[model samples]
Target: MTTARDTILARLGSPDGDPAAEHAALRRDYLHEHHPDVDLVELFAERLADYQAVVHLVPEGELPRALSRALWEGGYVIPDGVPEEWVSGIEPSRRAGADTDLTAVAGVITGCAAAIAETGTIVLDHGPGQGRRALTLVPDHHLVVVTADRISADVPGALALLDATRPLTFVSGPSATSDIELSRVEGVHGPRTLEVFLT
Candidate 1:
């Protein structure tokens, strides 16, 4: 009997073949065939919003102010780590980073590691520069900032750039669930609202 590893290897075709070249060619063919006219970022935004996520576009220089305004409008108390420059126009109460309870927060604004356009997914790895995972997960609303350069065309391309060792969260849209009756409900497991800001 063939071992599982041997079976998998056989199923993947001959080992003598250039795996990288074969995979690249396959990806190219698949994308051209199925996603010929896709404007990756636009498609991603459309899908995200279709899933009830609010999408916003802002200039790079205006990012901080936009974030502050979004937070204020969403009724969140600002945390200290959030730059004062960003919160300049907003009138929300300010608290130290340690003082803010995530559950009580109406929204949390964060920078994403990257976004995969084909699947309309945003990736978050809790790196020190990116902020804590709890900040994004515990809040009712998540406002993610994704620069144009950080957007990828599809899952395969996105995965190629991601670090496998890190704890990663992939979000396609808002948290949702379906009841036994087949009724669909939103905001069950995570953020009820997922807002994406593309710069």
Candidate 2:
């Protein structure tokens, strides 16, 4: 009567053992082996920019202005529902959500829920502050704001911090593809350009 799952479990060890303790031990070992001593936010910014992504740094009070500047430089007009206070000090064109066209937009700016330093990835859970999936995927360029406190050292670190119940988007670099002939192309599925702002 033993099922495949039961067979595997029996072969491995008793399922009655403390799963939480095993998980903690694994996490500790992983962190000790792979965690870097460098500042994650700064390291992530450097790596992202090195991969051809525009990099910026901003404080809490200066985020609005910085975002505005990035949008303007990228040739996008701000939307109406997007608060002026959310992006102040820069004058970009504004369009309605329905009217907004991806082909016309130079870029989209949003916040990231968490950033993984080991893999140089950003995780978005579609939170209110992070905006919708289309905002990052449709535009040719994406400007993501990542706070130092939210940056993690690796994938497991990031997963431990994120909620599984929410929608998650993980971006490592700009969208890219390769042809059968081995010719590489960028911006195939998502933003061709990725810019990171570490604060």
In order, what is each prediction's RMSD in angstroms? 4.9, 4.4
lDDT tens per residue, model 2, 1-199: 8899998876555678776676555535434316566877777877776566777877778877777656544455343344455566656344325247767777776667788887788999877566777777888878777878888887877887799889999998888889999998999999988878777
Model 2: runs farther than 4 Å from truth? 1-6, 9-29, 72-86, 90-104
Q: What TM-score, computed on C-alpha atoms, does each candidate reach?
A: 0.73, 0.74
Against the reference, the lDDT scores of all candidates come to: 0.72, 0.73
- Clash count for each candidate, listed in order shown: 0, 2
